[model samples]
Target: MMLFGHGDGGGGPSPAMIESLRIMQKNVPGLPDVVADTPERFFKHAASRYSGLPRWVGELYFELHRGTYTSQAMVKKGNRKAELSLRKADLLIGVFAQFRILHQNAA
Candidate 1:
């Protein structure tokens, strides 16, 4: 019985990681089911949570208006010190909605 991440170097699942997957599924069932078994999932799920994406995914959303980013790679890998904080996905979605409306004149 191979787990989803067996191809990698035997990385065990983090509870936080699994929770991210569940959150993703609950909100965006239409996208491909990608679990937190790899860096791609971590980046994507974090991106979704942080970025103000409107039912859309990919690089373009990262560059678009209303999108804010907290790069996991930088926080995890870089030397910059910053406070660790995050808004839940539901709150972020509402915030994004507001951002879209407020910034409609600029966008």
Candidate 2:
């Protein structure tokens, strides 16, 4: 039996990659079954889901690389960095809002 990717030399997805995508499509949480047939649809569903989340939650993924999820150490580091950035953004927003309130009261 010929595999889909063997000897194609076109840099297309390997068998393992296809298998992983199949697994992800079948199991990814919050992904609609209707959109699970292909990688592009799966990604579109994922992006739409992420976009609907709170700003800070989505901000946590602004610079995210999916590869981070492949390793425990990388996941930890990525989570920490995302948390730090979210905290910083929250603090800055609070400070700016306070400033605006103070300025309005003074005026």
Candidate 3:
């Protein structure tokens, strides 16, 4: 998958964000190989292969800074829920490890 971010730091996307995307694609199963490039590079690539392309590719805009002071309660609740989920995941991991060890010993 080719994800076009404004390359060379033209846009707000930092190098760390690009690297994180690469790492996620690498570690995740069934995820396509991701290539992060500038808009100019993607446009050039599309132009070179114009015949096989669609009429238009959609655009997305993200507002990184939004005033959310009113949603503090919601944010806190979400954080609490996430913490509970992580605790549950930790417990499951411990159980899985114990099971694995037991199975190995039995074998």
Q: Best by lDDT, which number?
A: 3
Order candidates by TM-score, high to low.
3, 2, 1
True lDDT of residue 40, candidate 3: 88
Against the correct fold, how does model 2 do in TM-score?
0.28
lDDT of each: 0.56, 0.64, 0.70
- Of 1 and 3, the candidate ranking higher by TM-score: 3
lDDT of 1 at 30: 82
Q: Which candidate ranks first by TM-score, i.e. highest?
A: 3
Cα lDDT tens digits for candidate 1, 1-107:
11443234587667775676677766585876544355667767777887975555556543443323444556554433332233354566688788764444645
* Candidate 3 backbone overlaps, count: 0
lDDT of 2 by residue, 4-63 (tens): 444435777777967766776675788554222556675567678787754333355545
Candidate 3 RMSD to the correct structure: 7.7
lDDT of 3 by residue, 1-86 (tens): 34545753558656887678868767577876666667888789877988676665565544653444455778878998999999
TM per model? 0.23, 0.28, 0.34
